[model samples]
Target: MELPPGWSALLEDYVAHLDAERGLSPHTVRAYRGDLVELARHCGVGPAEVTLPALRSWLSAMTDAGAASSTVQRRVACVRGFFGWARREGLVAEDPAARLTAPRRRRHLPRVPSRADVDLSLASVSARLSEGDNPLVHRDLALVEVLYSSGLRVSEACSLRLRDVDRERRALTVLGKGGKERTVPLGVPALRALDAWLHRRPEVAGPRSPETVFLGARGGAMDPRVARRVVHAATAGAGRGAETGPHGLRHAMATHLIDGGADLRSVQEMLGHSSVATTQIYTHVTSERLRQAFRQAHPRA
Candidate 1:
């Protein structure tokens, strides 16, 4: 759908701001753009002409069309972000979306693989790579190990450079969301996997290769998609049925850490969450597990 002229130009600038200044990933920028465009089309007016009523109507239309609560919430966020930027940049006199509200999103507990399941997956990947001197196998093993061991986001892991890993400290310097930097410790297994991969990396590194720690078959930086595929394949090979990905490994790491007595603040730092509240979701997981165990063990009715 063609957006109004003023809205179209404003959206382009907002998207650029989000990419260059906000440091959001391209996928996120695209989602924001999509949401804003749909809102602009629904409003049938330019940015300067938008009103709170129009915004409410757009949201109402979305709900009437059966958009999910999450979808509606994201669209509300997109509207708020666009207008907030426009007001600050002088494209709009006032932020019309300032008071706009979205329905509260239901907090769904993240699915975490059991510790035994994670171990089984890693063992399966190790066995598969044991028979071969293939660089790809080594890279996959290292990718999964680092993902589970340090709770690194898949994008952060894919974007890692050779200098980011400190062998002496057994830690990685990760550039996480909003351009924040943090150091997370690596486990012994992760260190060994990384060492194996690094030794074989020279075979795959070419003249055009970047300084990225992990390389693809074409001798360039590994993409997040490749990392996700590695996780899915590894999990499936381990005989697990539920859908698993790199983020699932991250959740499992955090859950397991809490279960094993890691403190909340430390887990927050390790996971790169901006707030400890964001890291508290794992506590819910542990509490639920405790409740389940109680139900199973208690004999009295």
Candidate 2:
């Protein structure tokens, strides 16, 4: 759908602001742009002409069309942020989205793999590693170990440069969301796997390859999608059959940390979450798992 010229120009400016001033990721900026475009398409007017009725009608139409509550909530947030920016920037005299409301997005507990499941997955990768000193196998082993051990996001893991690793400290300097950098500890297993892969990195390293810690088969920078596939294949090979991906491994790491008595603030820092509230979900995950265990083990009814 074609956006109003005014909306297009304003959105472009706002996107630039999000990228430069706010340091939002490209993915987030793209989402904001898409949401605003949809809103502008629904309104079919310049930014100055958008009114509360038009905004409400657009949201009503989305609801009528059966958009998910989360989608609606995100669009609402997008509009609120955009219009708030417009008002502050004098692009519009008033913000019509101020009165907009959306359904609360339901938070489902994420399926966190058990420690045994993660162990089985890593063991599957390790067993493959035993066949030969295959560089790709070493890379896969290191990737899963790092993901499960440090709870690094797949993107963060992929973004790792050789300089980001500190062998003596046993840590990785991960650049996370919004370009925030955090140091995450590497477990002994992950460190060993990483060492093995680094030793053989040259075999796959292409001439054009950067100093990226992980590389694709051709030795270019590792793609997050490919990394996700590696994680899935490892888990599926262990009999879990795609039950978890990189993020699931991250969740498992956090849950295990909490279950092992790690503090919430420390876990939040390690996961590079900007808010502690986001990390609190793992506590909920732990509680839910405990309830499940009680239901299975307790005989009293």
TM-score of 2: 0.94
Q: Give the least accurate 10-residue stretch of model 2, judged by summed lDDT.
A: 234-243
**What is the number of backbone collisions in each predicted candidate, taken in the order shown?**
0, 0
Model 2 C-alpha lDDT per residue in residues 1-301, reported as the tens digit of each score: 6777687789889999999988988888999898888888888899999998998898889989999988888888899989999999888999998998888777768877778888988998999977986889999999999999899999999989999999999999999999898999999999999999999999999789999999999989999999999998887743243248898899889999999999999999999999999899999988987898899999981
lDDT of 1: 0.90
Candidates in order: C-alpha RMSD to true structure: 1.8, 1.8
Residue 21 miss distance in model 2 (angstroms): 0.7
Q: Which digits, one per residue and each the tens of the lDDT, describe model 1 over residues 79-99? A: 898899899988889899999
For candidate 2, give the lDDT of residue 271: 99
RMSD of 1: 1.8
Candidate 2, clashing residue pairs? none
Local distance difference test, per candidate?
Answer: 0.90, 0.90
Q: What's model 1's lDDT at 9?
A: 77
